[model samples]
Target chain A: NAGVIQTPRHKVTGKGQEATLWCEPISGHSAVFWYRQTIVQGLEFLTYFRNQAPIDDSGMPKERFSAQMPNQSHSTLKIQSTQPQDSAVYLCASTISAEQFFGPGTRLTVL
Target chain B: AQSVTQPDARVTVSEGASLQLRCKYSYSGTPYLFWYVQYQRQGLQLLLKYYSGDPVVQGVNGFEAEFSKSDSSFHLRKASVHWSDSAVYFCAASRTGGYKVVFGSGTRLLVSP
Candidate 1:
């Protein structure tokens, strides 16, 4: 099933620069979720999309962060004017039921 | 709001020794608990989950967890440890019928030969 796929295993961005992460969910999976993982916070939910429509994004930062799932196949997470605090591993997951299949994740380093 | 707590940040054990990782959760209604493991440079993988019935659930890689509603705890255990079992484990909790999941800080296990 190849599970979920995420591009750019690692990323480096300077402070104030913009960064974009991409994820391709498993085929026929209708739910896509984005999460941030760090040593301190562990894993935190950022947003989710069900059947190509956003369902909840309350966990997303109020500023400089946005996510969109234009179709059932792929989703994108964009961070504008990135800061040092934004440096963390971004994980993407897709689920058909309650069990989620996770991607390897994109590690973002904001210097 | 639902939350999970993994009290131990790090645990060390010798190969062939018994292992246990503790988890506690807080929720108002029925809870769905899960254990996920992350190896170095890898994504998190589901170890096991508890939905209903049997408080004890078995998972992949010979791992098992017990759910105790009376104490609001779900602890992961393995009869014996192997060097390959060294990894970071996370405990997550979600309310029944809810999509959002709350994860614990995680416990890093170090298994020595």
Candidate 2:
């Protein structure tokens, strides 16, 4: 298994630009999660979906951050009018049970 | 709320020396604990996990962790360190049967030769 796959290992966006990150979970996995990691804040939970349905998004920033899991295999996180503070490593993980397997992650840099 | 604390931000040890990374957790009931290792610029990899059965669990690269209910800690240990073991270690916890996971800031290990 490829575990989980995240597109655009690195991305650079100017302030006020929009960015979208993608994730492909492992086959048959029912849960997908998104997290953001920064040097100052560490890792913060962004959102999650179970069986292609959003279960929790309490950690999302609300205004510019949005996530979608339209199908079982993939999920997307979009940041509209991205700001410099949004620069961080965006991690995607998939899980069948309690243990979660993570992908390489997308490093988003907003300048 | 469930939380985890990795007190040591960084630790240095010789290649052949024994090593221990401390982790303390705060949870009301039995918690599912995990230790994950992250290589530079890479995703986090599960080192070991403790759910119920055994207090001591083994993981990849000869790593292991012991769960202590009384002390509310799950400390990772290695018999002999290797330079390859140099990485950031994270301790995480979640409510039993819950999906939300809380992670510690992480402890960086530097194994010197």
Best by lDDT: 2
lDDT of 1 at B17: 97
Q: Report candidate 1's fraction of native contacts.
A: 0.49
What is the C-alpha interface RMSD of model 1?
1.2
* Reference-based TM-score, model 2: 0.98
Local error of candidate 1 at residue A96 (angstroms): 1.9
What tens digits encode model 1's per-residue C-alpha lDDT throughout A1-111? 888999889999999999999999999998999999988877889999999999999899999999999888899999999999999999999987677789999999999
True contacts kept of each: 0.49, 0.49
In Å, residue A17's CA in model 1 sits off its true spot by: 1.9
Q: B1-113, model 2: which lDDT tens digit per residue?
A: 67899999999999999999999999999899999999999999999999998899999999999999999999999999999999999999988998778899999999999
- Candidate 2, superposed: residue stretches over 4 Å from native: none
lDDT of each: 0.93, 0.95
Best by TM-score: 2
Query: In candidate 1, what are the lDDT values of residues B6-85, reduced to their tens digit?
Result: 99999999999999999999999768899999999899999999999999999998899999989999999999999999
